[model samples]
Target: MRLDASAGGPSGAGLPARLVWLCVALAAGVAAIALGTATWALAQSPGPAPTTVGLALVCAAVASIAITAGAAACVHRLARAHVRTKASASAGQPVAGQQVEVYVGLARRLQGLVHREIQLLDVLEAQVEDPDLLKGLFQVDHLATRIRRYAENLAVVGGAVPRRQWSRPLPLVEVLRSAIAEVEQYARVRVVPPVEGTVRGHAGADVVHLLAELVENATAFAPPHTEVTVRARRVALGVAVEVDDRGLGMPHPEQDRVNALLADPGRVDVGDLLRDGRIGAWVVSALARRHGITVKLQSNVYGGLQAVVILPTPLLGDRPPARPPATEPGRMPSRGEPTGTATASSSMAGASPSPVGARHHPPAPPALTRAASPATAPAFRDAVASGQAPRDAGAAGPLLPRRTRQAHLAAPLTRGGPGPVNQPAGDHDPTLMADFLRGASSGSGEPPAVRAVPRH
Candidate 1:
């Protein structure tokens, strides 16, 4: 990549200039040798030859000194260029016609470090509340170790340090929770699965980089009192981690911009957002890609933004085969069904009503076509009148059994063939209605004693 001269400056040009100077020195040395040899030849036939030879030697020394001085000047220039480059790269850019800014870059780097440190401390605090502080301490130590490792990696990239490997399994969830908790102190944020659990695979520094950026962005954009939730779920292909915030939702245009930035993983420039003093969303995108994960931003359920990172699953060598999906007590319903309902029709058939008011709508009748027996009619009528359907029915299927009972109840109220009576409207006691529907017959089998229906 050709770094812009104005951006990184002439730091890279130093080596070439030094090589040119070396060539000059070599040429000077050769010329001095030739001149000295000629002078020695001339002095051999004359008086005071040794003195002439000394003069030639002095000339050679002078040439050598001149070459050394030239080389020294080149070296000085190279050092200055190196310094300029370092200063330029670190200082970044200033607004048009303004003096180059140094504090901004330094402040950003410092802020990043401080934020990471605070996150580590929060994780440690979370661990302390546990009865087994040793485990907590281990987690804290692991996270701290990973952060240090990442810092070392950054230093190596900056040419200021060496590379190292993390031999022990790093506690990623601990570190991630810490990062989230640290941000939550000043920002409204919630970390899902706040407790410790192991995720498969070794993620290295990339996980930390992506999560930190995500949490930081969530904290920045979310409004006060708005919660930012970070959750991770293990999937068939991999683990999917989501950071959701309830704030001003990202507009479609901005979402598109974010997508474009993620498409090209190489670009680290946060662009205008950073330039305008806001942390660029691109930072999260770049880090996610580095870890072999795909990042996507979308509207969250609460009408805010969500940052999702899908990481590839790791293979466990020599491990036992994965177990089949076990049937849990509450099997979640299929996509089209209401949330949290069981999917199996048999389970729904025996399912009892929740405590009175707590009950959800009862399941619909089963698809059987048999006529309702006399014994079941009254029971069915009461269930329907109370807005409860039979359990044998499909939860979402037609209420055939209930409808049949309603027909029976309407028969008593209706004289002609079978239909609802056109009775006048009046405030009737609900209990009376229930009692009447419950088949409590007046001594005579006629309709129970009741007030005359009011005329419309």
Candidate 2:
């Protein structure tokens, strides 16, 4: 459509009036020169004045038309060249490269910051025992992951290779999970059990980025509360991952156009895609091209678009074989050795049963050389909740029952001094509360009933 609109040059309907005036002036100049030359020739030839005048007028008219045609052609050709140059510039080869460089630098810095933030969040989540606090930390970590993903995409678009690489091939299931974790609506994404396979260490990051873009798009465009299903399987060529969503599918023309863009993303204008709000597709294409991965979109049986990405054989790696348990050389099996089942059964049979209503307790934490510090409360609570040993040396003391902060409050109660009964009923009475707690802990003296005071 843009091509058709720009086909006409200065001579077309949209031509500026000034160009027409310039052509007219040139033609008039040519006509005047032709008339003067004709008059001079007539004077030299000694012909009839009327006939010479008539011939000169005819010559002038012919010269004007010829000059006008030549000038118009030249103007049209120049106009066309100018338009082509402008179009090429607007398509974003030079300008886009500069912008991409700037963006790539910023993205790299952002990635570093987000990476550190994620590490902090992980530590906090591990140390915090409250379920609510842990949930909030998880949310923050997820957002950080998303930010890192955007930074990585920007770097990829700028032709920057990923700095981090896995030392060994990662399982296909884990890759998909990592991708899914970056999406905003990841909870709605349902991943089918993938066949056993591993992605090559070099290409795993790109593959994860590619799949993340696809899954994000699916989750964004799918109907609210609908699940976006992702499936992976091994194919003859390599491994294929499919993302299906129940969104409104595009028309055949739009699909073809997008497919063509993905097929040869280099030919498409990055600026144009950015303007059209299709940067996701461009990012996916760029990543796929980098790793020799193939991405295609087609209509699925469910009347939605299905994006299928094929990781070529070079990007796929075989799962390493499981290593056998290390054993002493030349060691023979003993007949007295009990199998796993027999050992478990014997242990269970020899264990004594507990009495009814008795509370079960975890194994005692290892004793600390010194008492627990006040700061160790959080770590101690986390370990106790998880049923694990105290992580801190000072946290071991918290595992055993002890009263550290109530000694001052309970001193007067233990001394059996007379209660301050003359104090106002409306005022807070700490002595009565402390006495109640002391009696409860000691399981001896009856707790004194205190009158309830109403708030104003």
Candidate 3:
């Protein structure tokens, strides 16, 4: 198969340049020898040998310059080829800009699919009131969120802007909570109190994406079940968010290398990231760069790596307008609110609003435990701790499952008619509605009893 010349693969272009340089070096060597001999002959004649020798010497100097230039060019070409060969070997594939485009395109397609999947899940969650089934849906929802993050990472690394944009600035704390919601081990993450600030609407999505990557990395690398704390504080440049874990810290040298990469991600080699499985680092770097944010890694008092992300003043914004209550005047807002507005859901659930990584939804009903199996035990535990469920084999299929809209069609049929089948229904309580309406009329619309039900 022919390799692409631009991909740093073996190419005839390099060969020609090297060959040309080698030929030039050889010719220069010959010319230098001939000039030296001529100079020697002029010196032997002893007839104004200085002038003759000077002319020969100048010619030899020119030839020497050619020899040096040619040799240097040949060596440089050889070195580049060697580096490319090693990189290809390490990555197990050619590292090229085209491959990056391919990945970016794939990521974009996956993003669309995942977005649709989340929408479908939102519909199912609204229709189904079975606590166990709802648990499964939440798990699927969280997983889809994680997948979306991965896709965003690829897009960002490929220089793709986030498609989702917020019309208004979001509270920095709300953004942090949304980020925690995207990680697999969100249960283990904690947020310090009083996260005060807001990110500009234009940069809000990218900032959230960047923080999610950092939080995800912290959660994954930290010891299982250990706490990963995320906190934000005012800084001279802007606001600095710190994600600190308690796992074994990296060596100073390794930490320095990572800090350097995060500081100037452009210097990173894609092949090295592929070889080392450091795509998360690259994603964080890319997002940070887009908004002029600064990211760094350092050892913390907890004896683990602390990732500090500094959002510059430009990306920061004044506090946004107060979020509306989950319950509108006469009706309730559907649970299908975009992930960016999840704070409204959180506030309605009576979850503490101070901590950024605090719970967004109420705890799952006990019925979720019934779907537990040896295979899903870990996910179940994570779900319980996080007030969310992990994907269950019994509840949903491998890749985001599409719940059949006409599920009744699957029921066995008898001679008279189909067997009785249970139908999904929204979690609604007539009494709760009456009370909510009464409170709304009285202009004191307190949360109602139905708030006990989890709404994602």
Candidate 4:
């Protein structure tokens, strides 16, 4: 089989520029040499000989420089190709971008999975009272949160959005603490000065995420024993959050490059972070540029890096009150907990009576183990009082086997023939009538009592 290949990129464009430079250099050197040789041959005395020799030497130097440059470029290209081959061999694939896509796709899905697990774990955590169980749940929840952050890192590198946002403005202090809580080295982070401001709801989530990235970077590069600290203070224009660590600081040139990227991330797509391996700086820069936030890095007094994020006036708001709306009644809102508003099935849920259509439909006749006759109305009172499933004669428990009595068809009525089977003609007690009426009025799924025909 034969393969077709089309040259592009440097092969089609950049290769010509290098060749043109080489040709120009060679032409200059050759012209100089030719001119020098002619000058020397035509020289009538030693006075011009010296000038001719100098010109020839200059030509030789030019040729040497051009040749060396071309040779260096060839060696560099070979070295780069060798490195790529080695990498391809080690990784067992030529398509690294495909691997990145797969990894990021899985990471995003894993993020959702971890979030759901954390939510379930949160619900379970609230229900369990044992200290040990609560501790275990907290640990699991923490791990899930870490996994969520890792996934966010992958998402940011993949040029995707982060997965957190506050529906309302959060206090600056709270945002800082929340960001700190997300880092793996949370224990080492200490917040100071108790800032007073609110991160605008629109920017709260991204700000928190940005801060978390900076904080994580700080802690990761720091020694285990050293502490990373965060400080936030209200400023005239907005909020300034500083994250500092005691780790070895970044070099000045690197710091300047990072700052430049943060200041002007115009065309710098964060997706390049996959190849760049600078996830933290790229994430910080991308978020900062997007949110109108500014990030500046400086060497700390303790020989560490300090990242300062400036939240502009628009992204700042008045601090939220200590008691949020949900907590005004003395409790935090449960996640997605239903509000106090009335619902279609509210009657079933509370003291109010359910309308006929809104009530739970009564069990079908065949499913009924009991008579399901008018007498069934009274059983609801017992069911309600005892909080147990109502029972009647021949009524079996939900799981038990019971014979389904086939309903008999009533014969046509006639004076000589037996009349249709009649229900027992017991005297209607007013109290039973009242109880039955009460149960039915209460929408207790009570069937109405059958009426009897008076004897003529």
User: lDDT of each prediction vs. the true structure?
Assistant: 0.39, 0.52, 0.53, 0.49
- Candidate 2 on 259-376: residue-level lDDT in tens? 7778996565544544444656766777888887889988888787899998764565432111111122221111111111233332221121111000011111112211222222
Model 2 CA deviation exceeding 4 Å by range: 1-99, 320-456
> Least accurate stretch of 10 residues (summed lDDT) in model 1?
1-10
Per-candidate clashes come to 3, 0, 1, 0
User: 2 or 4: which has the higher lDDT?
Assistant: 2
* Top-down lDDT ranking: 3, 2, 4, 1
Mark the regions of model 1 whose C-alpha exceeds 4 Å error after superposition.
Answer: 1-165, 170-172, 181-187, 194-202, 266-273, 278-280, 315-325, 328-456
Off by over 4 Å in 3: 1-99, 267-270, 320-456
On lDDT, the stronger of 1 and 3 is 3
User: For candidate 2, which ten residues in a row score worst on lDDT?
Assistant: 352-361
Per-model TM-score versus the true fold = 0.37, 0.50, 0.50, 0.45
Candidate 3 lDDT tens digits, 111-164:
665566566555545554546545644665665676566556556656677877
- CA displacement after TM-score superposition, residue 264 of candidate 1 (Å): 1.5
How do the residues 1-456 of candidate 4 rate in per-residue lDDT, one tens digit apiece? 000001111212235534633453453345335334534433544332344434543453454334323322322222223234446766896734443454345446645655555555555454555565455445545545654555554555444666666443456777888788777678899998656556666666677778987888888888989988898764434568898889889889777767776787544433332234454565566567777888998998999999888887556542222212211233221111111222322222222111111112222232242232222233333333433233121122232333322223231221122321221111111133333353343233233232122123
- lDDT tens digits, residue span 1-456, model 1: 000010111223435644644553463544345344534444355432344434443453454334433432332333233334444666894322111122222223423442344344444344334344334333333333333333332322222312222322233355466455433232366666622222222444446555655665676677767777888654433457788878777888777666666666334344343333322243344344545567777888888788887754331111111211112224211111111222242133212211111011112222222122222233344434533343213222343443222222242242232222221111011233423432234212334234123223
Candidate 4 least-lDDT 10 residues? 1-10
